[model samples]
Target: MKQNVWLYIGEKIIMFVLSIFILSLIVFYMARLAPGDPLVSYYGDRAEKMSTEEKARTMERLGLDQPIYKQYGIWFKNALQGEFGLSYKYKEDVIQVINKRAENTIWLGGVSFLLIFLFALVLGSFCALRENTILDQIICKLGTISSCIPPFWMALLLILIFSVNLGFFPSSGAYDIGKANSFKSRVSHLILPLTVMVVSHVWYYAYMIRNKCLEEIRQDYILLAKAKGLYVHEIMWKYCLKNIMPTYISAMAISVPHILGGTYIIEMVFSYPGLGTLSFESAKYHDYNLLMILCLITGIIVISCNTLGQIINERIDPRIQVSEVSRYGK
Candidate 1:
């Protein structure tokens, strides 16, 4: 059993490394091959003013004159040495640019993630407890409609209503010009983006939770509990809801990427100055080094979360581990 556990760990590590390598290779090649003058990203308008010979020297200096494979080779070599190079557009270390923006993304994404799950649990339980009643039907419909609306559209709508017309909130940015340290300013800026993020994703998870609760309620043990004179709310709260906690946890783990993606979109729409906005700027300007690091960071997060979700699922239901072991002869 211990040997199998070790084997599984080794397999996951190997897969993670391979996934990162492949992701890097794809992004590197695609970025380089894409039609753009990266020199423009680095040198700005001076790139156009340079003569042919000067342009050649500039490209050579930036290592853009090399073959695509050679460029990737150098990048990979430097990356392994913990030197990811500088952002062409920002003229700063790629890591520094990311560091400056990462905190905002973390704060926004983290808060939204917690709120999504919290609301999902409450709304899901509410609907399940009231199953098929008017309240349940209304929540189901509203949730479905909200989930169907595109996050970008929802963000724009909120900005129009709350920011433009009513002048209730700041339209864009993480904080006011001089209020970076002000909690009130930060919260006001966050309201619209957070609303979009939570509304866009909460329903999907809530629907799943609702379905899981209903399934649990229909089980024989729940029937037995009912015969024992337990009230409906008592059975749901103590037994049905408790039984689905593991599944709820697994769902949360699997939803990290989903929520992160929504956060990115919301950031872009709101000009929130997070990694999402940085990612867009980097790609648009052909900031190869910055783009590579951003893609790798996101890829690592997404793959790690998915692997973690699998691990949690297997741990919660050992039959999953047993089945995999038998299938793979490990």
Candidate 2:
């Protein structure tokens, strides 16, 4: 039976609004708790030497003189209208500065995400097929080691090998912004960071996929197919894959947030130009606006991915989805 799309949309809208409210509250309190005062830093070392009248004037101009509730009301209003307010550190609109860096970060994340998906899907399937063979044994060991190493440690190791010792890749920074070069020049520079990021993402999901595939192979469907004279390859390529579809997509979707929020160490170690670097610098410099905005962005991305994964898994297996709705709706 057809359900009400409007009802679904209404529910989603409510959830979205509530999420924004919760995020704003958390960000506001977290910013307040963080060390240092934005005002003192904004005015410079001579902030204490400034007159009360001068200080009051500056606070009034920035709207910081208002009560906390009133300040949040104004900020929330503007934020809903797409005006994110000004940054004390950059002396520019917060959204504008963030957008500039967001483009590069999104691009890098997207490319790395694709590499991760492809690597995990192909190599994971191959490993599953070769289970109990030397190839599978080697892959399992390697994956375990790769997964065991922390992302930061891997990043430092890469830096030591590629940047510090060999000097093959630039240690930090994006590219020569002004230097004229072919399209290849920009892409080549991204290889090292992208490689490290992809490897980190790939192994986690690949192991999950391997385990999912193995479990799927034990299902009665596989036994039925095998008893029907199906080839082992055919059973794996078709039945086993179909069975593990949910697990694969779910695992991949879960990684989306990690990839988005992570890269801090990688960015810091490699000095890559991305949100990770921006967040680090903002926190170090006590740029409250930037720090809060980055946190908000990261939260939104993670929540969005989780919601997407739920929706997708439900759609792919409507029996479970419908059961869930029925259980909750009543």
Candidate 3:
């Protein structure tokens, strides 16, 4: 068993490296193939006046004149040494740019994730227990409806209601510029964005969990437990949840990067100062270095989450085979 586990780890490392290599290549080519050049964004209004010779020199200086394969090699080599290159738009190191913006995202995304997960688990279980009842049917219908709504639209609606009409929350920005950055004010700014994230995603997760719980409740062990005089809620908490946890962890981990992707729109709509908003700006300006680094970091997050998910799955349910976990690639 130990040997099998070690073998799985080796395979995982190889897979992760290969995945990163492929993803990086795709990101590199796609960014280059896009319509505008970084110089346009960098030079802004002055770009059109630059002569052909001047543009060539600028491209050469930025190494954009290099062959595609050569550019990839140079980028890969520099990346290993922890150099992600300078951002054309920011005129700063890519790592520094990312560092400056990551904290706000962590705070916003973390709180939203916790709330969604907690509500999904509790409410989903309740709905599953009362299957066929009016409450279960209503929740199921709502889940289906909510899943169809775009997150950005929900964000806009929240801004319209709470921020524009009621004046209960700030419509945009991470914090007030004039205030002393009190927790109360910061949280006030967070409310609309957080609500958009949680509300948009919660019902979908609950729907999925409800189905999983319903399936688990039909298993023989649950019936046996009930026959042994175990209460429905007790069997659910002690046995059913234990069986359900592996799936929940796997789903959550795999969705982390996607959730971050969703945050891009929400953050942009709210003008929140986070990685998502930063990425949005970078894309608009063709900040190649910054955009590529953002993609790389997101890919790494996905790979790391899948690895953690597999490990946690094995710990949660020892009966889960290594073969089963190995199939769950990010």
Residue 250 error, candidate 2, Å? 2.9
lDDT, each prediction? 0.93, 0.77, 0.85
Global lDDT for candidate 2? 0.77
Model 2 root mean square deviation, Cα atoms: 2.7
Candidate 3 positional error at 202, Å: 1.4
Ranking by lDDT: 1, 3, 2
Q: Which one wins on lDDT?
A: 1
Better by TM-score, candidate 3 or 1? 1
**Residue 291 miss distance in model 1 (angstroms):** 0.1
Compared with the true structure, what per-residue lDDT tens digits does model 3 show for residues 1-330? 576667778988999999988999999988888898789877887878999999999999999999888998999999999889998888999999999889788878888888888999998999989999998898888877887899888888888898889898889888898653578777998888888788788888888888899999999988998899999999888888888888998878867866777777788999998998888888889998999999888889888887887777767765675455565431
Candidate 2, 123-177: lDDT as tens digits: 7778888889999999888987887777777877877898789988766666666
Single out the weakest 10-residue window by summed lDDT for candidate 1: 321-330
Ranking by TM-score: 1, 3, 2
Task: Report the candidate with higher TM-score, 2 versus 3.
Answer: 3
